[model samples]
Target: MTSKPVIIVTGADLAPEALALLGDYEVAFAGRTPQAADLVALARKHNPVGMIVRYGSVTAEVMDAAPALKVISKHGTGTDTIDKAAAQARGITVTAAAGANAAAVAEHALALMLACAKSVVKLDARMHAGHWDKATHKSLELNGLTVGLIGLGAIGRRFARMCDAIGMRVIGFDPFAADLPDYIEAVPLDKIWEASDVISLQCPLTADNKEMVNAATLARCKPGVILINTARGGLIDEAALFQAVQSGRVAAAGLDSFAREPMSAPHIFQRQPGFVLSPHIGGVTSAAYVNMGVAAATNTVAVLNSVREPAVGQQ
Candidate 1:
């Protein structure tokens, strides 16, 4: 019998269609939230050539256990959970399914903005209570408002176009992009906070960028500004954000990612008013799942076959 190159999938099961695309590869499944010890054991035992990780940290210790592992394919866009420097030093290729969920994330951010602006949650609660409170007039109109986007990458650019189509004045901040759409004025990061009625975070979280949007940055934003973050949770300090919302400095916040997962008991943001929370489902839509899964699988196969360089990281 021919021994197929082994691949381990960490996290939930891949969609049936995504699995079907893998053809005859020998694939193993692991829990979505596997412990470090479990990961180390699995890697040592399976010695898979590739791994598709979602939401689990691929630490150096885990990597060390997997001597035969050649590639790490992140099931989603963010690679913050993985130890990139370690992987690079070991000459193991690391790739993420970047741009695969751009549209889904952009749509989620837009939905958050609308929900916050109109107080959708609160209004729904009031209606359910049988209170005739039609006199409440705390909603803000999104039309003609200034929407500031941080990091004009694939997701950011898509959001900018969507906001522009909705009659919003779109302004962007991306240090790397040389040019932007005519409708999106390329502004300094500070100016984006100052002029924006709504600020949507689309940047990746890195060591230098953790807690990038803290109390100091939040202080620069326009009063009553709406905040939407479908990106990494560590990008904003949850404590500082809670204080800002409590003090009325921030009107509302929509969060798809948080500092912790499952958001079980004792989650900080659960009790906050004017807050909309999603279970990190910004990029988990049906379409997004298929796109990202296919991308990761195809990328994994390519790396295994030595067909091309991995599509993520600097060499």
Candidate 2:
């Protein structure tokens, strides 16, 4: 009997379709929300040639444990969780199922923006309590609003299209992007900070850009700016956000991710009326889950078999 090839599943949740894609591979799952040590243990036990990694930190230790590991496939677009330096040093190929979940994340961003503008959450609570809020909670129109994007990558470009369809002017800041699509004006970072009515974060978190939405940056934003973040939680300093929102400098904020996951209790922004929080479901749509899973699995298989992987979107 032929020994099945082994593959390790990291922090990101997997759909059955992904497993089906790897027909003969022996799959070993590192439980959801695994730490670096857990990944190392799993790699040592499985001795995998490839890994379908999600959000866990893939450190040098984890790579050392898997001497045969040839590839690491990211289930989503972001590769921040993986230590690319170590992986590259070990001659391991890293691929991402980029843009596989862009639509779902873009939709979530739009939902948050609209909910904030329409006071949807606030009104829903009042209605459930048998109270009418016709007079106090006024809503804003998005038709003529200008929405700024921090990054014009796959997800940001997708969100820009949605904003255009809704008659909202779109301007964005992305140092690497050139010749943007119609209706999106590429602007400097300072322009976005000063001129935008609403700002959304779609960029990856880097050492240079970490907590870019802190106090100094927030001070430049137009008064009553609405903020939305479907990206990393570390992108925004929650303390600064809490203070800004509390002071009404930022009228509302929609956050899908936070600095810490499975968020702690009694967070300052927990009960704030102007903030809408989601448990990082930006890319978890039913359709996206399958797409990302299959893509990641395929990428893993391709690299292991020395086949060229399909063209992936922005990562």
Candidate 3:
């Protein structure tokens, strides 16, 4: 049989076990941050029957070039990068490895909460610069604080249980989640804005809710509330967040993702007090990386082999 071709359209390569599952196929990787034109070139050259996406946008132009492309598998949960309507128009099956990385992401969310409260990054930098500065970046204890989660999906639920175990009250506004446990009491959006000492966003980025954390919402929040975002970057308005953080209205923020990838220098967040940032690695762990890779690879293979996939609540 002729070798089947598949392109990994981002920086990550599938784990060895995932690659082993595709022994019958040929694989190709596009180096990190490839231009759209370069990605289109790869599609033209490979004529791949399937594509595994991780980072960067997969536009309609790239899809149009691959005449044989039948499947597009997302390396992680977010499908916002891929042009789904365009793929569907071409009769391509789009799949994502959802919930496989929930544990890792939830752990990162907790890490951000601790980091924001304790000034982990800033203090480490202070020590590096030969200044103790312990008096300035005072730590906040979490034992009695209320944590408001924006969404109660896989990551949100895991984080909630962790907070509950630590003796913190857990509440949130998840309209989609029905029959939540006693630990997580669902509330209205207005209540989350007013009551939470720490607000962690876990909602998917919807067109209706983009930049939901804007000036209007921030004005209503309790002063000095810590903000944590391990979900989509587009969820928060960067300009409003900067002003809030600078003015001490929002005490601190821990962000694992940003509105712009490779956040530019002199951006509003630079040299700001009580804010920590990570480069979108919330779901990246030794185990989750491999699990996600395998899950996405299998999803693509299943569609190609006419094998039915288990129903997953994925976008």
The 0-to-1 C-alpha lDDT of every candidate, in the order given, reads 0.87, 0.90, 0.87
The list of candidate 1 runs beyond 4 A from truth reads 307-315
Better of 2 and 3 by TM-score: 2
lDDT of 3: 0.87
Error of 2 at 178 (Å): 3.0
Local accuracy of candidate 1 as per-residue lDDT tens digits, 1-315: 228867888875887777886776778877877877888888888887888887578899989998888899998888888899999998899999989999999999989988999988888888899976767566888899999998898899998999999899999888888778799899998898799999999999888879988999999989899999999988889999998898888999999988766666777688779689999998989999989899999888888878345556846
Name the better of 1 and 3 by TM-score. Answer: 1
- Rank list by lDDT: 2, 1, 3
Please give, for residues 16-64, the per-residue lDDT of candidate 3 as tens digits. Answer: 8788888778788887777778779988888888888887778999999
TM-score of each: 0.94, 0.93, 0.92
List where candidate 2 sits over 4 angstroms from the true fold.
Answer: 11-13, 307-315
lDDT winner: 2
For model 3, the stretches where C-alpha displacement exceeds 4 angstroms are 129-137, 307-315
Ranking according to TM-score, highest score first: 1, 2, 3
Pick by lDDT: 2 or 3, better one: 2
